[model samples]
Target chain A: MNTEIQEASDILKVIESANKLKGAEEPSGVLRGAQNAWDLLSDEQSQKHITTGSGDLNSILGGGIHCKEVTEIGGVPGVGKTQLGIQLAINVQIPVEYGGLGGKAVYIDTEGSFMVERVYQIAEGCISDIMEYFPYRHDKASSGREHLQPERFLADIYYFRVCSYTEQIAVINYLEKFLGEHKDVRIIIIDSVTFHFRQDFDDLALRTRVLSGLSLKLMKLSKTYNVALSLSWIWRYRCSNKLEVFVWLFFNDRLNTKDMQERRNIFVGDDRFCVLCNISASEDHDHLFWPCPFRRSCWSSIGIQLGSHSDLNTLISGVKDTASAGLFSEKLL
Target chain B: MRPPAPKPPLATSTYNQQEPRPEKPLLLLASSRAAKLSLGCPLLDRFLSGGLPAASVTEIAGESAAGKTQLCLQLALLAPLSPLSSSSLFLYSDLPFPLRRLRLLAPKSRPDLLDHVLVAAVHSPSDLLSLLSRAQHHLAHPSRSPNRLPIRLILLDSIASLFRSDFDASPADLKRRSGLFFKISAKLKELAYRHQCVVVVTNQVVDVVEGNTGNTVAWSSGRQVSPALGLAWANCVNTRLFLTREVDGNGGSVKRHMKVVFAPHLPERTCEFVIRRTGVFGVEPAQRSNNSSEVKAHGYYLESDRTRKGGSNQHKQCTHTSI
Candidate 1:
């Protein structure tokens, strides 16, 4: 009993000391002061937004890029992820006379994909939009003419070209002080946060820790500094939408003999027969859904045609275009 | 061989009147204002909140060619010029001391600047231990009476070299190393506090391998590089600063970053600077500094405009998508 009690007391002492050290050394929590829900709501309301240069995207994003929040804009290659980042960086410098947040930007480029010519074009586009909107406010426009220049816009966006993951982390860790000194900066856009982390990293656990720490630091920065953070990165989802769920459910049913054939193919590699058509075609999700003769009629009978089964996103968009007209109208009615 | 009798306080006061008596509380308070040793750069001084504080162990940890030695050289060069008017002692290990580079950083006006900085080559951690322990006696009570300034700035460039191969990665060896670290730091701190001197040590960085899930962001060269000696020596230092370098691909200009990892007084802050022939200079945003008046005017206008339209605030409603 005495030995057990001594061990327990020693453990308790260790736990107490650990807690004390944690409380003393945890620097993340001490930077920002406490705020109630009302303060947050008020701060949120009064926050200025950076226009995305596209009215639709701006409208969809609840008044463009939000300050004090991290908005991830992700898409495949050639979908203009870099373009939107550049657009936001340029549009952030839009004059306060217009309905925009007249603040600077810090652009962290990991992939060396940032084009200055594209940024100049976007700046020109923003200036034209501002001129078109407030043509009558001649005095204000004249006074802010220098600020509206593409050169000035390009100059305001502080660009840090980081080569590797360590440089990326260093730049991000350095941003708190950078933002503190440059108070005019209201947005931080990391063009690609995952480019360096995705490749050349052998230890999976260390990569996850570093990436999570980077992301948490970013989130805290956006909140503490009240700066908008836009991170563009590729996300791989195992299951994304209802279509994927339907596919999952179709395979999940053990009672369904049709899916059983596809499942049985896993064990019996030679028997590659389509369950629905009884044809000697290799069975897969795409073949069973659209291309197979037995299911093609059924899909046409339901008045749905699949276009471009190259990718899931295109497939979803195709379905949305054909089926969503009636569904949206019915909901509206 | 008897110990000298303790001198009477009144007699010592008259004897030490040539220099300010350091024992008085009033004089100590006056000296506290001049406690920091400036690094010779206004921008760095500002970034460090009036340079390195006296009576503290400051560790400047960095990878190779991160300008750690350059910074220490500048600090040593400028130590005698500070308000305290004290000299610096630089103990180097591993590589030979860069005397040529030191001379390049030395200004043309101060021809005898090197004389103020005392340099010594320490072969091992044991050598450093004995040196510092011996210096503690000299620091507490200086034998030399007058004319010469006290050594208030003590710098050991690359403390990692001394113990890199001395200890193996075993529990027992690590425990011994940790004890030595504590002993060295305790003596250094004692010397600093008793003599009101500054202690600065440069530490090399090693690649972070695994299980380092700490809040500290010590990174370099596409991998996380942590300060050598691990957590044992980390506890000994009063302040820790990390220096990182990046080579801009196209321009090829090397940008060096210095950040405070942890400090009693300073917040975690970083600044970018470049090393030039003269000294290390901070890379200020050129346009911002040049067009300061215009930017200020623009900001003033915006502020007034904001206050004028403060009463009529509006919010645009948009579709909210749950992430």
Candidate 2:
């Protein structure tokens, strides 16, 4: 072969070897659009999970709530979907030494169900539980070594009560920025996530588009941030007090005047019935929630068996700070 | 063992055959089976294999107070089982919010989930029909709607309640209303399939008299109840579940039976459940196995036939030993 040709071929070989070395450094240029599986495995952010205390629940969830995912809780009215939402919100606040996620909660309340009094009660219960059993654990944070006030949980929780659908959309849209501002926030909870979609919007087609956008945004947020987005929605159904009481009291199925009336012709509204029980009393929240003879009997079953010497007002209203109050409020929420 | 044989010269066609390097077929990453939302109730979740399948219509029917509404609420709460979506639309016709009763029945679940539900009521069938179209439009998009499932659930508390109230309306109008009803169901099915949202509709049941219990046969059961909506509505559902109360002779349901009457994917079977302050659960709380697929492989269902099963018996034995 000619000397010139040989020299040119040698240069080509050297350039090819250099290119192969460069390829090994990055591998297929995939680094531009993708990542190395080894790096992904070690990324750490994708593996975080926030646990709900109920083992049964965690088991069904694959691994509790994935910190980098959205978890939705769906249920009908009176099914305590919100109660679980609140439970997780409060459970997330537990100190890491006590088997909690040990982070603050962001609660978005749309249905007017968030009770601050109820939150105080939950915090009190969680704190007492921590103080009682968490001492022996390695958590110096809660061993009176670290000055962490129990009430600090309440302060750490960021709550947004968006009364309208627009407000809800606005808050969710900018939640990423908010989370960036608050690095300590671990969970974002929207109590009854679907309230405004049903109530405010007459344009459901538009609602679906908007909802789909929000869902996509939430999905993206979960992927990008190390936070769990938990949504809880209540399925409220219209039921009369008479049927409810009968189902509670008797174990048989019998058609009532209302059922028969509806079966024969039309379902007319009956307002005189007590909202809580069919025991023939005026329907109201205070009566239904606490003071009624039936409600009092139910409360006694919980623990603080309101003794004859105990005042109902004190037991119902003045009950706070005590263990019984914590129990009551915890159960109430 | 020996010197390598002289290599044969490549045929002219060997390099000319246009051999392109094989590449991994553009991977279409997606769920092997359809994506589903968990119901959060193990018995029910297992019965449906992790919850309601997306892009399908699930009809829940039962007699009044048969806990049809309760199951709906459970699904509404369980929609969070889908990590990405948080929207649930609960359309009520005329029922009041039984908050007090719910507090008792659903005591353990978080109280805040109720706040996220979007609730609307329709007084008439037309109102319901319009509401459904509006919902459809709300989720519609100009381009291909998002591939990710959105609007976790769209519920019609009693999709047939207003239709049942059409008894006093003109026969011709009732016919038109019933026709419109089918349209809503069709539109709902399309939305479900397209958006992967769960569309659940609660239906009522009517009583049917059995062969008469004459004096000669006084001990026999007298009546049987069946879902009310006729064949037209039946064709629209991907899953039809029948719920009934298990009365204890004192006029109360000690338990409820959620029977899969029919489904495109599931066979007929019934699971017994009871409503508690913690919501609806099976007679036995479902003990979750870490290898969920192993449990599913054994069976995601508790079939009546399994009482006679052979392989399943060994699984039962394994469970006992594990405990």
Candidate 3:
């Protein structure tokens, strides 16, 4: 017993001495603080830069969502939420000069709304001007023409459709394998998360529980991959009226009795309807972002104010100018 | 023939006169042979330094029928019988098509390759995790050394399907799903490092808003939000390849064209390949000329004279084309 006690004391002494040596190796006051500051300054430039498919959107989002954080875009149908998600994927994959990421994008479609043909159309529009205007062209003989085939553009985009929750998990595992093999992916989009959950789990509590789990997973993934993640959602019925009113006010200068009457007619008696209300609003991208009543409120709620009845092109231009002005003002100040 | 023993330590406070030696640096023996086993495509094999590095994950993402699965199938069939060493293993989980289709696709693949390839029809993420853990155990046994048995490649087909099917795409659900995917990928990376294997996964794309126009049309529609799995999968991968389809103008007769869109630490350009009867092979330079009238070439042609004998190498070189 005496020997055992002595042995225990000896072990304790060794441990204490080892710890003391470790502590003594570092001078712990101002030097430690200086070390931390140096580390922070050195690593600041290497921080991840996320590109939210849209230039205006990226500006609003402060250079896209931070890597490994969740950013939700919720609105009624035809409000450009899904469109924003898809654009981000393509833009994220594009080179930086084109106001894109030049990184890979992963997309999971839950609402059966992901259309590959549309992506090609957008790609054609985006790249055509660049190809035509760029003056640096070698001789036709030296320059190979076959590489610009539309099929080539289509091949750069990846697509997936999910109809159930189980398939969602499978897709996740597949994504894990993909990231393991290829590490340049920087953006991920999920079109309308509510459909899968709404279809599979009926109970709200269980649904939220499942959603929380998914949210945490995405957050971790973004951090691990250093990628920006965006999720689309369909607003529930409780928020539909407010959305409708908001849209009505944006389209009509005055939200008087006639506009309310038109809104009433548009909404009708259908309590859970995802209808296309304004004919003009449904036509282009500008109307979808700033004037589309159903989504206008969402943008405002997030502090992105929009002018009444503004078209998408004008709204984007306005947003850009405003953002630049803000930046310029900050620089001046 | 034992050496003479030294005297015991004395209770003295004096230090030794000999100088302290610096610790030997840890030397990792990265095998070129192992890398060659993972990349089945000859052009890709050469482009990616023989093959993908072991202990890292690679992502192959694309739309449906964009040849993502076909690529996976090619790797599965080629990994085990690769010239690197004997007794390599390939694992395929959560495949969309039937296992029979994989067999049919690679009919000419070696019988031994099929024998070593393990296909698991996983229904849930938990099941996949459990199987992966078991695989790690099998690969990590000390008895399984380099010359004995080497598990070189692992492939997971259609990652989006697995997560999208099980979790709602709600922000909350996506976060959770991505977290789980990140965890699994972390485990796979650890396993790869410990066992010297390459892990590959395939992902699907989504439609979102475009950046310039804020439009949701097919052309303006961006990409789908990958469930948390999508993001997590991207995070853990060491390289990423985005695949997309295009119309091959075979003199007005449209053919499906598959090209690589993105890869990390790789050239940011596209390369064309076709999944033919023999398997995924690079299109010959002669065939490429036929399609040359459409657009200027941006990426370097991955033409191998060794693979295609008596093939013409004349092709126009342009690096400005955006397609």
Candidate 4:
């Protein structure tokens, strides 16, 4: 028993010592000590924004893309999510005197859609914008000419091409060590984080988990390293929500009613009786449009019989066929 | 004969060091008090006696769309939210991971919960084996992983998929497949034991045809469905939870049921749950009792045939009421 007690104590001592060494050896910036809200606010005030090169865009974005935050840029394919990513990669390197962050960028291309030629052109455009805007001082312009070269802008941005999701994860995992060595990197851009993820996945739940995991890691990296993490993804529309919006816009007057039974819970009213036919049945989409006695009479008077089906497409197509057949028969006679 | 290895710094080496370890009893005593990871739902966690237990393999077997994947995803998301603030490793061998559904389930405050869960896709048995081996190395060297928090939860979405397509039913093939299953489970058990991690593996269920009485699984959703991979694979898991889904009486929504088929600590139990956009929620006990009583009054009752030797049949049966 004595020996056991001594061994336990010895193990505990080793554990404590190992924890201390781990704490001491941890890299400086990775360890984020607790800070109050006031400190956080003050830090935000001191944080710099990388210019997006458009004045109106900069104004709306609160002086451009703020550092120490992960910003997701999403839009429909070809709406220029990648373009914005490349522009930011170039614009992040704008020199300090011009009120820019004056830091390099790390661009991770997952889609292989990143074009070096377009990036060079954007870099040229950025350099020209700087010279035109800050040409008040002749000496400053001359001295900054060398720094404003397009090639120099291109050189400052490090590009990594990842072919698969696994490669994407591996690159992201290596980023911490990379950032430690290259502190000048002010921004990291993943050109379409959803490419390989969207394809070849048999299990959708796993995809969500994997993508969420990646986003979480990116968020931590941005917070710890004080760099702007920009992630681009194919802007997705939730089909149900979008379809509902469209249907509401087109058929709102026909479908939605104040005394409708579906709205009874919301209005707390007793008038759920069908407004068209006073058969005392509750007013709903089916009762109002499909089976209502009044609606049947209206259709009969128009010489177009209606079916019991609730599908609007079939109903409309049936009506068209009846009308056309009647017109053709009249002409044939 | 092994060569002497170089010593790591004393303070940095304590937690992971294998030699000079504390006595077995002391280790067990400390681990017994160690916190279990929550299943996210309060009631389910209570039913699980805290949450998923460490150092054991738990299998969740269910048919398609039975919410097995959703339950696993919920666990992955919840592991980080717990006070332990530990990370998880999700090994997906099935379909594309559902990022949108997970986002819907994630709480508003910590949308970044996904970041704490590391996910890897394994296409086949060999791929899964290699990944597990590599994972063992990564867990041993905590510095190698991206997140600071150690992985306390390792979830394999479905174990049956990797083995289902890769092997034929030939006797030799079956033997090889069972060997692989044991190898995979052993690796998972080792990792769970060494890291004190909770290992959860989801499984696919195969329908049991009538007249085939050989090792048939129980009935769920009025149809006989049993966990796939037969008895050989069943022996590897420490605990088994079966999920079943049936259309509600109203016919608008699905009512999901989870039952503990076997576990060392937990009793044979069953519960009703619903999957919402927020997360999976267990039905309250009061509501559950009321529901069962109502069903019984309507001449219906849950038939859980416990008398069967190897397994029990759990299904809802209804009797006609003479009006």
3 against 4, candidate with superior DockQ:
3
Candidate 4 to truth, TM: 0.41
2 against 3, candidate with superior TM-score: 3
Q: Where does model 1 sit among the CAPRI classes?
A: incorrect
Per-residue lDDT of model 3, residues B144-207, tens digit only: 4443445667778756676778788688887667656655665565565445566787877665
Select the stronger candidate by DockQ from 1 and 3.
Answer: 3
Can you tell me the CAPRI class of model 4? incorrect
In each prediction, how many residue pairs overlap at the backbone (N, C-alpha, C within less than 3 A)?
0, 67, 117, 22
Task: Give candidate 3 misplaced runs (Cα > 4 Å).
Answer: A1-333, B1-34, B86-97, B107-109, B142-149, B210-232, B248-264, B290-323
Candidate 2: C-alpha RMSD after superposition: 31.0
lDDT of 2 by residue, A1-333 (tens): 699999999999998787766565654443433677776677655565666645677778865776766888874332345556665676676666565667877888654444443344445545555566666663654445352454566666777755344446556755776676677777888876775444323334434545666787778776775433321110011123222222221211122333333454644466534545668764433344455677777776776554443443455454533555445544543
Model 2 misplaced regions, further than 4 Å = A1-333, B1-34, B101-112, B141-150, B168-174, B209-222, B250-253, B284-323
Q: Report, to 2 decimal places, the DockQ of model 3.
A: 0.01
lDDT of each: 0.66, 0.56, 0.50, 0.66
Candidate 1: segments with Cα more than 4 A from true spot: A1-333, B1-30, B141-147, B285-323
> Of the pair 3 and 4, which is ahead by TM-score?
4
Total backbone collisions, model 1: 0
Q: Is candidate 2 or 4 superior in TM-score?
A: 4
Alpha-carbon lDDT of model 3: 0.50
Instruction: Single out the weakest 10-residue window by summed lDDT for candidate 2 chain A.
Output: A230-239
Put the candidates in lDDT order, highest first. 4, 1, 2, 3
